[model samples]
Target: MYTIHFETLGCKLNQIETESIARFCADAGFGVTMAHSTASQAETAPVLSIVNTCTVTAKAEQKARRIIRMLLAKFPFSAVLVTGCYAQVEKAQIEQIDSRIVVVPGTAKDTLADFPQFFMDLLTKAGAPKTAEEAAALAKDLRAWQPLRQIPAEQTENRLKPNSKDTKAIESINKFRLATDSFMHHSRGSIKIQDGCSNRCAYCRICIARGESVSLAPAEVLKRVRDIESGGQTEVVLTGVNLTLYRGTLQTESGERKMDFADLLEYLLENTDTISFRISSLYPERVDDALCRIIAHKRVRPHFHLSVQSGSNAILKAMHRPYTAETVVAAVENLRKAKDNPFIACDIIAGFPGETDKDFEQTQELCRKCRFTYIHAFPFSPRPGTEAYTMKNQIPQRIAGERVKWLSDFACKSKTEYAKSFEGKTLKAVVEKRETNIGKAVTENFLHIYIEENKQTLKDLAGKEVSVLIKQALDISGKDEETEATAVLVCDGA
Candidate 1:
């Protein structure tokens, strides 16, 4: 059987897409193998490899290029196909890097299901037949075939300049569909309920790459949730580019009902039983009373990741963020009041254009007041085509780095304090990792707990909710710390 290897980089949404592509390949009569598997390491490597890349930042784009180069070196003869944000935004740059690599933009990602047939057509033109023996032998000695050279000029031209039919096919994808039967991660499932973004944050390139926002219908989302629940998935995370912007209309028994993010959550909580749901992220202004009330449901995990790009109102205004510092604080306060010990996290850009020392101090003050569970802090890297890139008074790289370090230190302290607060408290956790004498689980509030238990018991507990008592919270906040010392509840009778 012909084998294919796959690799994914970036967010949970990208992971979901990669798994879907793998399933599509399998349905196309290709056996799947890990990119670094022993089979792939053999003298005859897998004939095909797919890399789903990320371009969230310049660093992310660099990583994608590095991975592509590494894969090329490993599988010299195999066909390499690259897709995702980086490929979408910088198609010419990626194509120039390697002539053999097939570049598919984000708009053409859904068309990945058609890639296997595309590959076969190329092979047939190169004198390879569809018979089992010939296919196997072709895979073994694929280096001699030079698939890239074999590709017809017309086919290459079509890929470079897709006609209106391809455009229409891409535009028609309104609902999120899973091409894979199983998720890459067994402990929890992720469903992309929405895609793209409408927000034009000054420093963001994601909106440019993802295009306008599009939400999946509530009925389709519920159907996917039910299917995941039936598959024994105890938890499902609803992911999207801008989750708060999700809007759709669903036909119910009552009649046609328009559903926003909150309504969708209520519908899922009311209809689904056996599966808990968690949202990927939200905007502070979108966290209305209705959404808070729905989130109070036990099935909705007590974790809220807000896109609070800056705690300083001045900086926020410069970044074109929709909410103010006061708005963000109020949102967190309301969420805390609605749910007990809910994990509140935020995305913070340390330094932006025209940010003064006073602005940085305001951010620190806000961080101290809010007591966030964690903060994803980074020095703002201006991207091409973004307003911030050309804005005046850009902070020096050294100053930005210093600001990031200060914010990171504050975040570590807040996280440590928050985790310590749960010491001796029993929380519901889902097992994610198992070992001979230890295991790791994540609580609904987004705490990572390490439990001391037998491997078999922990393995069996995987994908199931169990009560875990937080015995101790070790201070593992150092930069190089690999595992936090979180002692959890022991199994009864173990």
Candidate 2:
């Protein structure tokens, strides 16, 4: 039996795929360990290694390459399987390292056969082939590239929409990564609802890579949620490509009418006490009152994240985003007025092709006005095969970097203010873990609290909700002083 270890670097969708692979390997009788790498372990070295690599940016590609080279050395005797996005995009480059390294793309990542046995057999047939230098030039460019085989997301329309299918599934799975997965810890895992994108944003490669959107059936969804809750996961988060796009995979009561995302949210909220339900990022085009009203329920945490790539209307339109400044503002206004301790976050992309200083400034203004709790900022990088790759008016790296920094700083400032707003306000914050990495607790609104990890007053509070007086807001430096008013959690929600 082979000992195996896996490292996933990228989006949530990749993490789910990695988890499924882990489940697969374990079921195949492989011993699993959570160690950082496959090659070295206190008990024994793994005979196999898998690097679920990401290649969203040039930096990501470099990182993947570097990690692959390092791991390939660590497991000289082990078979290394390179898979995921980087594997899909940089197939030739990965194969150049060693024929021994089996590179599989995202499409093939799923539907893989008993890879361990297949790998063992391949290695046996190839023989040890001795010497790292000799093995380094190993090439497996013997077969022709597979013809483009497109699989439509759950529902198949007899029509084509670019690489819509793939993008949808990819986005569907990504919910696990970017969404609030930490809340569902130690119980049932969250289920991915849909996948792919057809928005064809000029600056995003997601549309090309993930494919078109499709959703799971209401029955399957209910079944999975029940299974997760029964198995002990107290919460479930619904995620996917334009999650609002989730309709259904199978026929249901409302005619062959599949259950939409809003329906599912209502069902979960009404039917189960599965601890909590978190609504991950839903594109602006999909946000609606039905969903909003359900979210306003006292049981539902006052939280929702928007998929806004650019705040400026011109930049947003250029990026092919579906919503505008007013839409995002309206959503925030609704949530703030309805829910308690709500945290609003968004995805902001800076330095797109043709983006002007004025355009970016408008985005800045939008961010300030919205007062988002957090913003994930990314500098535009051209992705081959995407619409944005060849667009004109590209921003320089330095300029893009600067914009990204400014946006990130702005979000952080907003987060600080958000936390301060809760000062003297009572909110339910569950004590998750007290890792030395950081002080730990997540508020109902999803603010990560790192207070004194002291054993009784603090450490003793793990998994318990206390009446926390938000006290003074922590600074960017994370230092605490007497001038800082301390937080006090009084009543236990339990």
Candidate 3:
């Protein structure tokens, strides 16, 4: 069996895909292990390392490159496989990094499941020994397979030509990959219901790297959810590239019917029991009254993230985003109406190509009006092929940096206020980490609560759902604080 260690960097979608790939490798008789750092462990070193990368920002790409180089240096004898959006757009550049590094685009990530077997077959054909150690040693000098290197940067579709698989091998893994029982990296379950993106926003390069949007069949989606529920997980986050764009077809006795993200949520809630559903993110324009009603269900977590790039109408138009500032406020209003004190978060790009002082004020005004729980604020990074890259009137880096700081400061204040709202109330949380006398868990509304053991001894609460009473909200400026506040819990045995 080949030993493999996987590293993921990006959105929840990337994380879910990494988990699926790990399961595939393990099921195919490969030894899957978690290698945290460069210092070698007493156990056997992994022979292969796979880095699932991101391309949302130039900083992310730089980080991927740095980490790949570090992994290569750490495991000198192991071969590295780089895949994801970074690999998709910068294939040639990544290929030039090292001969031992194999580059596979995000578009063909599903094919990676078949790669280990294909690799083993190749070694056998070359008269290498069949033992795991012997095969791993022989695999050290492996280079990129020629056929898989045929994907050009311009190709957006699933046009991979791997030498190992037949025409029947080229199917989306969304239809087959189910929720993993053993989560190697996370406490809760993550089910990737969608992949790829069809939208082409001016500042976005993800659509180019990911290609058109595709969703798992609704039946398969239900099966995946059930699989997670059977594993005793309390929560499952339904993730995707553009979650609001998910469109699945369901087979009913009265012929076939279409299901959007809202319909899927309603169906899953009706069919499944006990497990809670958390949506990764939603487009502001798609959060209508019908969707709000579905999210209002008790099974659906009262936390929503909106991909609202900009609040200024002109800046939004420049970014090619569909909705205006009013639409975002309306979405927030609708969500608040559906669920009391819902934790509403948003993504905001502070410095777009043509943002003026008035435009920036509009963004701040929107935040004030909506009173978001949190904000993922970042300065715009021009991607190579994006329309915003060549556009004039780019915001200066100094100005952009300042704007980011302003929005981020506001977000911190907002998050603290939101965390304080649930003080003294008992909420359901899944324990993420446990120490001797203390534990850390996240509440249903996504608030991080630190559990302090009382007279009872602390148990292994990691991955277990328990009731937590919020004692006090911590000061946001604390140095050593790991969670939003300190929580005292009353577990069954404790």
Candidate 4:
């Protein structure tokens, strides 16, 4: 029986992927050491390791390599496996220096009832399962004994995947029930409602890798939420390749559509008091009046992550992003009309193919005009197999990197200025993470507030939504703004 350590880097999607990977390993009969259950939760040991990485930027790639080195140093004789977008596109470079690390581009596609068997197969190309007594005995023992171990206060499933037995990992989680996470780690968990994307935005390889979009039905989604509720989750987040694309019905042959995202939201609001739901990122073009109205529901978190790839109209057309900048502005305005000053997050890519000084200025102007609190600024990275990969006059790497820095810094400044408006004002918030009374929570306005230190009681606030005033903006590095007062909790978001 081999033990494994799971590490994931970047994005909510990456977090979901790591969970799926762990589930796969647990199901395959290999015992998942209860050590690092969540991506942020880490323990130093467990020689066998897997790094689910990200390569959205050069920095992310460097961090992936750093983690790989750190893991190798910790587990000298351990089998190491690397997977995710970074490995998928940069396989040659990844293997060149860390040949000792087994690289699998699309790990989710590979079935290893457990991580150990995958490792065993890495040792030998066959991922064949074991009905053999030695392996069976170990699997059986691990299963029987797992429940007795002191799992952390917050593990969704105390007993993880039943000994692999060649079953698909995460299928169970995706099926009847989801693991319950204890602690205040997102009481409303993100459920991957769909996987993969079809639109290949020139500078992205995600579409090519994840393939066409496929969505999970509402029934299945409801079942999973019910499971999470049974396990102690209070809310469920509807996440997807593109959340707006959940197209499924009760009966396929009848050609009758059961429900779309809007319908799903109405159903969840009506049927389950045990659940509060939030939809993940949505494309600006995907938002219709129906969807926007559903988002206006009081129960839904007033947060919309609109993808505004570029502000330049020419750049948008060249990048093949569906929405125009004007359309994006209109969507933002429409949401504001529905849910006043709702926390709108957006993605901005700088230095795309054919991007000129005028185009960059357009992006800057959009940033100034758009009222987004959370701005994810990224410089375009040309990925392999993408149309922009071969496109000439590619934004110089250094220039792209500079753009990323400038945009990100500017975003932080803008976000801080936006957040400053809420200082001392009462706003509903949910306690997300905590260390005593000193913890972090998100106001419905979608502001991240750090609970003031020294004098507070966090005892009643765990997973509870309380009223908070926007105190002061903590700089990206955690330094506090002088004019800002401390965050004080007043009571729930809904």
Which 10 consecutive positions of candidate 1 have the poorest summed lDDT?
160-169
Local accuracy by lDDT, each model: 0.73, 0.63, 0.78, 0.62
Error of 3 at 384 (Å): 1.1
Ranking by TM-score: 3, 1, 2, 4
Superposed Cα deviation of residue 67, candidate 2 (Å)? 1.8
TM-scores for all candidates?
0.85, 0.79, 0.88, 0.77
- Which pairs of residues collide in candidate 3? none
At residue 368, give the lDDT of candidate 1.
82
Task: Give the poorly placed runs of model 4, Cα more than 4 Å off.
Answer: 1-3, 23-44, 89-100, 107-187, 252-255, 433-438, 453-461, 475-485, 492-494
Tens-place lDDT per residue, model 1, 243-298, is 98999899868999999999998988889887889889999998889888989888
- Name the candidate that leads on TM-score: 3
TM-score between candidate 1 and the true structure: 0.85
Per-residue accuracy of model 4 over 1-494 as CA lDDT, tens digit each: 55577777766766665665566666655555423333344554453577877766667889888888776655555545677667655655765654346555542323323344435444345332232333333333332333213222212111112221121112212221223233222434667777656665666655544445666777777666677666655556777667666776654476766777788777667766655676678888767788788778777777778888888999998887888888888888878877867778889887787788888888878777876766788777665556776787777767777777777777677677767777768877666543432466666666767776332456445666677767676565234432222477554333
> Model 2 compared with the native: what TM-score?
0.79
> How displaced is residue 455 in candidate 1, in Å?
2.4
Regions of model 2 farther than 4 Å from truth: 35-44, 112-188, 249-254, 423-439, 451-473, 477-494
Ranking by lDDT: 3, 1, 2, 4
- Can you give the lDDT of residue 474 in candidate 3? 76
Residue 265 C-alpha lDDT in model 2: 78
